[model samples]
Target chain A: MLPRRLTRPRITLGSPVQLLLLAASFALAAYAGVRLLADDWFGVALWFVGLALLHDLVLLPLYTIADRAIVGGLGAVRRREWTPYVRVPAALSGLLLLVWFPLISGRVDRRYRTATGLQADVFLARWLLVTAVLFGGSALLLALRVRRAAQHRPPAAR
Target chain B: MRDPDAPRLPSSPGFWRSPLRGPWLTSVLGLVLLVGITVLFVTGLVSYAAYNPNLSPVNDKTPDKGILGFYLFAWPTSPHWLYRLNQGVHVTLGITMIPVLLAKLWSVVPRLFALPPARSLAHAVERISLVLLVGGALFEFVTGVLNVQLDYVFPGSFYPLHFYGAWVFFAAFVVHALLKMPTVLRNVRHLREEKNDLVSPRPAEPTVSRRGALGFTGGASLLLFATTAGQNFDGPLRRTALLAPHGGVDPGSGPNGFQINKTAVYAGIDAAETGEDVWRLVVTGRTGTVRLSRTQLAELPQHSGALPIACVEGWSTSDQWWRGVRLRDLAALVGHDDDPPDVFVESLQRRGAFRSAALRANQVADPRSLLALHVNGEELSSDHGYPARIIVPAAPGVLNTKWVTRMTFRGL
Candidate 1:
C-alpha cells in the first residue's frame, strides 16, 4: 500500500484553482506588458521600478520607525489596553495626511482653484482640526475606559 | 542541535505576534479589500468602456477612420447622469478604501517580514502574488488621487499607465484570492463559532480587543467617506464635504459655470483666433468643404436644450440651457447628412489631447446634440468654448470637443 504522505493530495505548486487564477492573471499581465512596451517602455519601467524601491526602502522604513516610536512612547501604559485607541486614531490621521498631502501643503492650491473655482487653503486647517478631534476623542474614550476599569476592579486586586 | 519541533522563539514587538495582528483580523480586512477592489475594477472598466475607443488602429490624426485613438468614444448623452454615477462612485469608493487598505496592511505587515521568509514553493508564489496585488493597488490609488487633483507628477500619460496597471493588479488579485481563500474561510468560520479565543499561534494578551480594532478601522473609513463623498453630492452635502477636492462650488456657478477641464490659456488657444470675425465653422462632407463664419452659424436655426457637462474627474454640472445649430442639420447643409455619417469635430486650439474628436453615428443622429454657441441666455464664454463647441449627451467631458472649428463627415 502507498504511504500516507504519498497518498495525500500534494499542493506544493498550488491547487487547481490557484493554478487557473495565476495562469489567467499572467495572461492579463502579459497583455499589459505588451501595451506598455508599445507606449513608453523605459519611462514606465523606471517609474514602476522606482516606485517599488522607494516604497520598500524609504516609505516602509519611515512608517515602521514611526510605528515603533508610537509603541515605545506609551511608557508605563505600554501594557495598557487603551494603547490601540491612540494607535487607531494616529494611523487614520496619517492616512488622511498621506491622501491629501498636496492640498494640505498648498502644492496644488493654484491649480485646484483654477480648475474648480474653490480655494484649497482651508484643507490644512481642516485636516489639523480633524486630527485634533480624533486624538481628543480617543483620549476621552481611554480615560473613560480607565475610570470604568478602576471602578470594576475588586479592592484586593487593586 | 536545535529540536525540529521546538516552539517558535518569540520575536521583537514589531516582528512578532500582537493582539491586534492575527489571521482572524487579516481575514476580515482582506475580505474588505477584496470587495472594495472588485467594485473599483468593475466601475473603472465601465468608465473605460463608455469611451468606446476602437483600440486596434488608434489614430490621433484621422479620428473618424483608419486607426482612431484610445480616447475615441462617442460618449453617451442618454441617461444623462451615466458618467456622473460611474465616475462619482469610482472616485468616492477609491477614497473610502484608503483607511481600509491601511488597516489591512497594518494587520499583515509582520508576516511580510516573517522569519525564514517563505517555507515552501506554494508560499513563495503566494508572496509574489501579494506583492503584485499590493503594488498594483497602490499604483492605481496614488495615480488616481493625483490625477483628480490635476497633479501630473508622474512622467507618463495617465490613461494608458492606469489602464494597464489595473489589468495587472486585478490578475494578481485573483491569484492571491485563490491561494488565500481556504484559510480565510476557515478563520472566518472559527470567529463565527467562537471556537478559539485567539486565532494566532502565539496568543498575546488582549491589550486591544478585536472588536475595538474593527471599530477603529470602520470608523476611519466612515470618516473618510463622509468628508470626500460631498464632491459627488449636491446642495447641503457639498458644504459638509469640506475635504472633497471639488466640493462647495458647482462647476456651473458663474458666467462660465460649466466645469472648465482645460482653460483656453491651458489649451494654448490664442484669444485673437476665437473672435467672431476670425472664427469659422468649417464643414467638409460628400459635396465639399464649406466655411461658415460665426454670423452664418448664428443665422442657422438656433435650438436650445438643457444638458449636463459631466467631467471625467468626477464632478458634474447641473443641466443648463445650451443653444446652437444641430450637428445633423449642419451635416445636412453639406451632403451625406441622411445616414448621419461619423462627424469629426476639430477645435481651433493648436494643441491638447482633445483638440479634435470623432462623433460616431449615434451622437450625430441624436437631435439633442448641438454645436452650442450660447450657454444659459448668454453667448459662449471663451472658457466655455466660445464661437462654437460640441455638446452631446452621455459623452466624456473631453469628447464633447470644445472650441470647435471644423466638422468632417466620414460617409458610412
Candidate 2:
C-alpha cells in the first residue's frame, strides 16, 4: 500500500511560530531594560507584566511543543527525517531583540512602570546570563553523556 | 615544608591524584599574581581607572598608561606599545586565571554538588553567596565578549553593573574563601610543601576524574585561546573590567570615582553675565514679597547670550545652550544684585521622590556658577531646562537646577 500523505493539523499559531512568539516576549523584556539603565524608571515596571505573560503563556507552550518535536524528530531521524536538526531559537531570539529594540518601548509611566523597567533591564541581563550558563553547561553535559554512552556501547562488527 | 594543615602526598592511587601538587602550585602562584594585579588596579597610584581621559602626556593628549620610560597612547592614532602591553597583560592573565579558577572549581565540585550546611542561617547565606558568585563570574566573562564585538553590537547598557556589582561579587568571593578555608589551606600547604598533620603522607587527589578534570582544564584553555584570538564571548567581564576607549578616550575613565563626563561648568548658567562684579542671584522673596510671582519686573532689560552646556554621560554633542537673562541683570530690576545670603531655586517639577542637595547664595554667586542664556551658542535646549538654569561646576551635576522657574534669596 502507498504511504499515507504527510499531513499536519491546522493550528492558529504554528508550533515554530509559537516558539518565536515566546522568544519575542523575552526580547521585549530585554529591550525594556535599556530604558531602565537610562534612568527611565517607568519602563522597568512594564517588563515584569510582559515577562509573566511570556513565561507562562507563550514560552511554556512553545518550549513544550519544541521539546516534544525535537524528541519526536530525533526519533524520526533514526526512523524518518534522516537529516540532522538544529534548534535556532536562541539566535533567532537574539536577532529579534537587537533589531526591534529601538522600534518599541514599554509604557513610560504606569503604576507598574518603575518595576517593569528595572525588571526588564535586569531580567534581560539575567536571562542572557542564564541562557549562557545553561547552554555552556548543557553543551558540556551533553558531550560527556554522549561520550559516556559511546564508551558503554558494544563494539560494532567490521 | 611541614605546616600543620598540609595535604598528604599521594601514596594511594585514586582517580584525582594527578591534580594535587600541580593545582596547588598553580593556585599559589596564580593567587599571588592576581592579588598583585588587583592591588595595583584598585589603589589609585597606577590607576587604570580611566583618569583624566582626555589629558594626554603631550598637550591636549589623551591620558595613557606610562611606565619608567615607555608610554601607551590612544588607539587608532599612535598605538602605545606599553599601554597595549598592560591591556594585553590584564587580558591574558584574566584569561589564564580562568583555568586556575575552573580547576579550583573542579577541585571543589565534590562539595559543590552536595548541599552545603543549609540548616544554619550562616550556611544558607554562604550557599546563596556562592550561587551569586558563580553566576556573576560567568556573566562577567560572557557579557564582556558581547561588549567587545565591534560588528555584533549588543545594545549599549550605560547602567554600571560591574561598577555596582563589584561589591556584591567581592563579598561573595570573600565568603566563599572563608567557607573553604580549611581545605584551601590544605591544598596550599601541599603545593608549597610546608607543614601539616595528616592521616598519611601522600599527594592530593581531586574529586573529579582525570577525564572530567581535563574537561575543565581543556575548556578553560580553549576559551582562553578563543579570547586571545578575538573570539571569546564578552559577557560580565565587560561590566567588571575596564571599558574600551571611546571618542578618542578610554571608556570607564577614573579608577573608582573620577569620571569626567560632558556635564560641565556651563550646563546651567546665564551666559549673559560678562563680569562677576555685576553678577546677582535673584532669590524670589525679599522682606515682604515672601513668594514672588513672574510679574515682579515688566520693564527690565532682559538680555540673553548663548553658552555651552555639557553633561557627563559622554554625550557631549548637543546644541542646547545656557539660555537665561542674567540673574544680576534681572535682579537689578527688583532686588539687589549683592548682599544676598541664600538662594533657593525651585524645580518646575515637584521636588519629591528624589534625592536633593542644596547650595548657599554665596556658593551660587561664586560666579563660576551661571544662569546661562544659550547652550552651544544657541537657544536653550528644552530638555536641558529651556527658560533658565544654574550652572554649578565642580559641584555635583544633580545640584544644577533645571527649568528654573523661580529664584529666591533670603538674608537670614
Q: In model 1, where do residues sit more than 4 Å from their true spots? A: A1-17, A37-43, A49-89, A113-120, A132-158, B1-14, B55-76, B115-117, B191-207, B250-255
lDDT of 2 by residue, A1-158 (tens): 54455364323333453344334433432342333234423432333234334433454446436644654575556632211112323422332233223211222112112211112223234335534654576567667866887788888832
Interface RMSD in angstroms for candidate 2:
19.7
State the lDDT of candidate 2 residue by residue for B43-114, as single tens digits: 211222222222222111112222211332221211212222333344444444545454444343323334
lDDT (Cα, 0-100) at B34 in candidate 2: 47
**lDDT of every model, 2 decimals:** 0.74, 0.37
Clashes of 1: 13
Each model's total of backbone clashes: 13, 79
> What class would a CAPRI assessor give candidate 1's docking?
acceptable
- Each candidate structure's TM-score, on Cα atoms with residue i matched to residue i, is 0.83, 0.34
Model 2: share of true interface contacts reproduced: 0.00
lDDT of 2 at B336: 55
Superposed on all Cα atoms, model 2 deviates from the true structure by an RMSD in Å of 21.0
